[model samples]
Target chain A: MYAFNYHRPASLAEAARLLASNPEAKLLAGGQTYIPTLKQRLARPSDVIDIGGLAELKGITEEAGGVTIGAAVRHAEVAGSALVRRLIPALASLAEGIGDPQVRNRGTLGGSIANNDPAADYPAAVVGLGATVRTSKGRAIAGDAFFTGMFETALEPDEIVTAVHFPKPEKAAYAKFPNPASRYAIVGVFLAKTASGIRVAVTGAAPCVFRATALEQALAASWSAASIDSVTIDPSNLNSDIHAQADYRAHLVKVMAKRALAAAG
Target chain B: MRISMTVNGRAVSGEVEPRTLLVEFLRNQLGLTGTHVGCDTSQCGCCVVHVDGVSAKSCTMLAVQADGCSVTTIEGLAQGGKLHPLQQAFHEHHGLQCGFCTPGMIMSAADLLQRNPDPTEHEVREWLEGNLCRCTGYHNIVKAILAAAQTMRGMAKAAE
Candidate 1:
């Protein structure tokens, strides 16, 4: 990792000040992705602000018929939390199915969504459940508007994500075809029946997590796995690499969506 | 940066670069060579250790990040000069060949058993996903973990 000054700010205000003063300072949440990037010399920030220990940014709270999870809450904590399991077992399952025990232990929800890796599992959940991303600036961006593109979000440079509020879904499930080696989703799908509507979010299939509108519509008409069986997925915009072809990814998207729906049921 | 942490049971403090990994700090600075670094990319769980009594990849974490946190490495597993139950079980079950991944596998398995005592074989296998053992095919390792869980349970019952 590159040599950079590390600052452990006790408060979000201090962290924001550090980021504002030092234009190149990066907030270190879990260091799961950022550390690796630094080690590879991919990024060279002037300062690294550590928010891992900030008490204000670490917790899960059930309120207003939804669960609000702090940004610094680790994946392992979410996976192990009885509250998360009781409120949203599918979210707990999704957290459990992330990278491995060790990775889950250290990877934070804030870091995961902020990095916005195209293949990440959390994006599917965030978009599928229509979660609200709350930033330090007291802005609440809807899940649909938060994710802009691959490795991109609506967050400004210094703006920090404080918490994510996920409404209680009638039923929700996430299914992923993970790469054997990395355990990242080759094509993951998250299905949820919410008060707003039935939502289907597909991850690791394109530049960013996207809603499968056709599948969502089909499921809305009839909440069944077979409902979207004939709904064709377009391969034109899907990702194609050595792991899988565009057409293959499109096919996996459909399969995973169906699986997610069945699992949700 | 000067950071202090409880390793094993002793509080140790040292000056280290901000970018230094916890594994590097543990092995190089603290001379705790039991935590090995097989894959620096965090894929291999060779550097698995307990941070604040929970299993974490030391290689993926910065030494500075471990400030004021208690860490436990494989070297700390044995108590009173006796092998930990997991270690003994591994030996009895012939869980290793090259011994390269033993330390990490033992640590990860220990954490798993702590969380879920008397875990099923499937649970043990799933828990070992992060810890890779190319030599053993994980057959003996799984057996060792199960055996250790049984022994630990028996010991706990006797103590109770």
Candidate 2:
């Protein structure tokens, strides 16, 4: 990795000031993806701000039938949180299944969503559960609006993601057919039954995680795995690679959606 | 940048480049070579270590990030010249052939045992996902961890 200045700010205000001042600075949260990118010389930031030490950005709070997770809260913490287990067990399971134990120990929810890797699991949860991303700018972006494209998000360079608020659902579950080597979702699906209606989000099969409206509508009509058997997912815009072709991912999306529905119950 | 951290119960400080990895700092700077770096990528767990009492991929973490933190490498496992129970179990069960992945395998297993004292065989397999053992089919490695867990549990019971 190339040499860069490192700054560890203890407060959110200090972090905001640092980022605003250093236009080429990048916030380092968990460093799971950032560190690897740096090692490969894929990115060159003038300064790397370490936000892991900021106490205000590290926790999980359960209140009013929902959970608010701090940006710096690690995936392992989410997986082990008793409050999350009791409130949203599906979310906990998704956290538990990310990467591996060592990776989970350091990967943070904020970093995961901010990076917006098409294959990441958290995006599916955020969009599927209709969660809210709170920023340091005092604005909350809905999950659907937060993700822009592959490795892209609505967050500005200086805007720090403070927390993610996930409203507890009646029932929700996520299922993924992971690539064996990378453990990234090949065609992951997150299905949720909310007060508003049924929400189905699909990840890894496209440039960005998206809502499967047809499957959601089918499942809303009949909450069964077989309900979406006739829904043919369009593969034209999905991702294609050596691991899986677009057509195969389209097929896996349907299979995973059904599995997620079965698991949500 | 100058950073300070507690490694293996010793307060260590060093001036390093911000890009230096924790594994590189331990192996090259501090001469704590027990922590191996099998893969530069985070996929292999050969560089696994305990940072603030949780298993983390050392290669993926910058040395500056570990400032003021408590770190425990495989070298820190044994106490008073005696091998840690996991080390003893691995020795008895023939858990390794090349021994390249032993340090990391032991560290990951130790972390698992810290959180779940009595892990089932299936649980052990699940927890070892981060650790990759290419030499042996992970059969003996799993046996070694289970045996170590049993011994540790028995020791705790006796103490109680």
Candidate 3:
């Protein structure tokens, strides 16, 4: 990795100030993705602002109708949190299934959604549960609007994600056909019955997490896996790479959605 | 930049480049070579070490990030010239072939045992998803971890 100035800001205000001042700076949360990108020389930044130590972006709180998870909270903490397990077990299970135990120990929720990797697991939860992303700029982006494209987000260059608020769903479950080698989702689906209606979010099959409106509508009519048996996913826009062909991914989307629906029951 | 931290129960300080990884600092700067680097990518667990009592990939973490933190590498597992129980179990079960992945495998297993003292065979396999053992087919590695967990549990029961 190339040499750069490292800054560990103590507070959110300091972090925002540093970000605004350093145009060529990158925020380092877990460094799970950033470190490797640096090692490969994919990115060169004048400064690296480490936000893992920020006190304001830490903790898991249960509010009136939802759970607020601090941005810097590690995956292991979320997977093991009793409050999370009791409130949103599906989210906890998703966290438990991320990269690995070692990766979970360091990787943070804020970093995952902020980076917005196409194959990441948290995106499924964030989008499926219709969560709200709080930022250092004091704006809350709806989860649906947060992820824009592959490795892209609706976040400004200097905006820092502070927390994610997920409203408790009536019933929710996630099922993924994980890549055996890396544990990333090859085709994953998160099914949720929220106050608004039924939600069916699919990840790893596309460039970004997307709601399967057909599956959602089918499930809204009948809350059963069999209801979506004939729901067909279009393969033209899905991801086709060395891991899986787009047609195969489209097929897996339906299969995974059924599995998630079954699990949610 | 200058950073200070506790490694293997010893307070250590060093001046390093901002991009230096924790594994590089341990192996090159501090001469604690027990921590191996099999795959620099986060997928491999060869560089697993306990940071603040949790297992993490040292290669993916910057040395500056570990500042003021307590770190335990493979070299720190044994105490008073005695091997940790996991080490003994690996020896008996022939858990490794090339021994290239032993340090990380042991460290990752140590973290698992710390959190779940009594893990089933399936649980051991699940917890070791990040650890890749090309040789020995992971059968012996899994056996070694389960045996070590049983031995550690027995030791704890005896003390109680």
CAPRI grade of model 1: high
A1-265: candidate 2 lDDT, tens digit per residue = 7778999987999999999999999999999999999999999999999997689998899867999999999999999999999999999999999999998999999999999999999999999999999999999999999999889999998999999999999999999999887789999999999987999999999999999999988888899867879788999999899999999999999999889888988
Query: Lowest-scoring 10 consecutive residues by lDDT in candidate 3 chain B?
Result: B36-45
| Candidate 3 lDDT over residue span A78-156, tens digit each | 9999999999999999999999898898899999999999999999999999999999989999999999999999999
Best by DockQ: 3
DockQ of each: 0.86, 0.90, 0.91
Error of 2 at A2 (Å): 1.2
Give the docking tier of candidate 3.
Answer: high
Interface RMSD values for all candidates: 0.8, 0.7, 0.8
Please list the Cα RMSD from the true structure of every candidate, rounded to 1 decimal place. Answer: 0.8, 0.8, 0.8
Taking chain B only, the TM-score of every model is 0.99, 0.99, 0.99
Q: How close is candidate 1 to the true structure, as a TM-score?
A: 0.99
lDDT of 2 by residue, B1-160 (tens): 8999999999999999999999999999999999999878888799999999999999999998999999999999999999999999999999999999999999999999999999999999999888888899999999999999999999999999
Tens-digit lDDT track of model 3 for B55-152: 99999999999999999999999999999999999999999999999999999999999999999999999999888888888999999999999999
What TM-score should be assigned to candidate 2? 0.99
Find the 10 residues in a row with the least total lDDT in model 1 chain A: A221-230
Model 1 per-residue lDDT tens digits across residues A111-187: 99999999999999999999999998999999999999989999999999999999999999999999988889999
Relative to the unseen true structure, what is the C-alpha lDDT of residue A15 in candidate 2, on a scale of 0 to 100? Answer: 93
